[model samples]
Target: MSATIKYDDVETGQQIPAADYPVRRVNLVMYAGASGDFNPIHWNERFAKTVGLPDVIAHGMYTMAQGGRFVTDWAGDPGAVVDYSVRFSSMVVVPDDDEGATITVSGVIDQKLEDKRVLVMLTARSGDSRVLSRARAVVQLA
Candidate 1:
């Protein structure tokens, strides 16, 4: 499907509405199963502490996927995203509780490029920690 957002209608520096994704221990377990990462730090709090982490952390790729979801959801089509990348800046600690942790994602249109594409800059934060840095996506618009 084509993107609902047209390149001609978009402006640089426009803000996308922020979205929050909650990460729970069970979600981490499911992600580990699906991804085959199965790393202790991602699922085992004691093991993670033994390894010098504050608590069980979410997988880096899972965190990146949330940022991608934010971009694709805004673009209105997953296929609209032609390129995406991010730098892992901090860990998302998932506590074994009902609230768990939250990853808040927001984006801004950084530049309008040729070929109906735009450069989007993304920010993902969990509490006071900046979970992603240098996050960007190139999306093809209608």
Candidate 2:
């Protein structure tokens, strides 16, 4: 489906409100099972520590998906996003607790492109550490 947000309604440098996504150990475990990326670092705290990580971490792709979700949710259509990419800059450490950790994602309309498309730059952070770098999505707006 096409995006409900029109390209003319958006401007370069306009801010997209930040969204928080809570991640827990169970989420990582479910992700591992779904993705076939059964890496111990994603769910096993002890194994993660042995691998030099402070605690169990969320999968990089999972974190990236959160950023994509932010963009798609804003655009009002998942199919509106024609291109998306990100560089994994840091880990999202998930504690074994009720609150777990939170990944806060925000975006800016970086550029207005031809044919009703716009470049959206994304920022994803877990606590003070930026988890995704160079995150960008090109969306086809209505």
lDDT tens per residue, model 1, 1-142: 2358888889999999899999999999999999999999998899999999999999999999999988888888888889999999999999988999999999999999999999999999999999999999999999
Each model's C-alpha lDDT?
Answer: 0.94, 0.94
lDDT of 2 by residue, 1-142 (tens): 2347888899999999899999999999999999999999988899999989999999999999999998888999888889999999999999999999999999999999999999999999999999999999999998
- Tell how far residue 36 is off in model 2, in angstroms: 0.5
TM-score of each: 0.96, 0.96
Clash totals in order: 0, 0
Regions of candidate 1 where Cα sits further than 4 Å from its true position: 1-3
Query: In candidate 2, which residue pairs clash?
Result: none
Q: Give every collision pair in model 1.
A: none
Global fold similarity of model 1 (TM-score): 0.96
